[model samples]
Target: MANFFDFGLTLDLLRLPFVQLALVVAVVLGLLAGVLGPLIVSRNMAFSVHGTSELAFTGGAAALLLGWDIGNGALAGAIIAALVLGLLSRRSSEYDSVIGVVLAFGLGVGVLMLYFYKGRASNKFGLLTGQIVGQDFASFALLMACAAGVFAVLAVIYRPLLFASVDPEVARARGVPVTALALVFAVLVGVATALGVRTVGALLVLALMVTPAAAACRVTASPLRATVLSVLFALVSAVGGIILSLAPGAPISAFVTAISFVIYVVCWAVGRARGLTRA
Candidate 1:
């Protein structure tokens, strides 16, 4: 426990090959999740993040069973779930019901797959929880490519997409192809969620993806500023948590989630204070 605050140990950890790559993964996932999170909140699809991640879990489990790369399985599962959810929830009235069913089913599938894997237990736990170490160059490069694609899509669709997210009816009236845009955005969110699942685990992926943006939104209504702050908050949480966990032999997910939750709480209080002071 004495080494918990040892900066020297943390710096030494950064010298490891896997640790170097994991840091890069943290930064990229942070930025990707940050960009998509506010839009998810605004569109009221926060629930969908969890649902999609459950499917990502199933995918990772399946990959483990088949000896395939877990990241590929996770990304495929997430994208499939996102597309299905988008199609099924075309009418807002059915969004909750459809996603709820999908979430449960995904969990069951993952459990079944994991049960038959017969591998070291740590690998299974890592999928459900998170592991900050053991990252490889191949996985890191794939993640970077996927992140770039996701960001490019976001840049192209952001304007009309934002409009559609804010008010679908209005966006539809403006001929913005709201349905198409929503489907595209959900797929992008799925991509981010998959990367997040790899970084922080499926259970805690939403913390990186949603909480920072949610906190940022509490303080700012401007989309651009909120996006920037969300990215900033997520980046700090990802990189800072890794640094803190290196010396203490703690879980990266725990530190990351705790940091995100603290940010949200502080921002919420500040927002409340601003409201009172204004009134």
Candidate 2:
């Protein structure tokens, strides 16, 4: 514990450029993930998260194969995959199968591309495992722009999305555009997944996007309160995880994932206790 304290103090003293940039971007992106994740889970779009992330892996691989930018590859893959999901959601019944095929096909394509790009092992490893320790100025700007866009779209679609998520039949009866809301949420989730890949890697993207919100949901039944708590939890995880990851004996992924899981467990226990008390 003493060593950990000293390590944290040392980090506070040395505000390196990469570390600063990473913390800023991670906190913003993490908050977005936390806020959106619960909505997706409550709406039963967890599989969509998996589908988009898998397709992102394929996009990154293809970009490498074609000598293109990896981030663009990820974004393209996520958007295309989101489009497929949006289309499938129209039928409702076929959505799961569509997601399954998209996941499988994306992984297969990624594997084949990785095989062809064997010489760039480091890049491949980073794309898969998330070795981006910092964002450049241009990347930071892009992240901010994307974050703004996501928030703007969500603001407009929030009501309908919430209604549809909580009760689609009721929402439809009440004249909510369920189909449009689904598509909008799909696009938002895709963007979130693409943004998340920068910090968490495709393999563990859910760590950033799902864990915090799920944890928040356990502690709060109210949507607004849960959203606020989720954002806080996500920021804490991102900033704390990044700092811990920089310590002498810790990996960032381990720190971030552990923090997220711990938060979830704590919330779940608290929620259960509250339930028991009520009973």
Summed backbone clashes in each candidate are: 0, 0
The model with the greatest lDDT is 1
Tens digit of lDDT per residue, candidate 1, span 38-73?
898899888999999999999999999999999999
Clashing pairs in 2: none
Error of 1 at 235 (Å): 0.3
Task: Residues 1-279, candidate 2: write the lDDT tens digits.
Answer: 564557766566348787788888888887788779879878877778988998988898898889877777888899889988898667878889999988999998898899999555767776776654525777678778888999999888888888899999999999999988888788889888887776677887777788888898898878998888888888888778777766443445566788999999999999999999999
Candidate 2 minimal-lDDT segment of 10 residues: 245-254
lDDT of 2 at 157: 82
Which structure among the candidates has the greatest TM-score?
1
Supply candidate 1's per-residue lDDT for 97: 100
What TM-score quantifies how close candidate 1 is to the native fold?
0.97
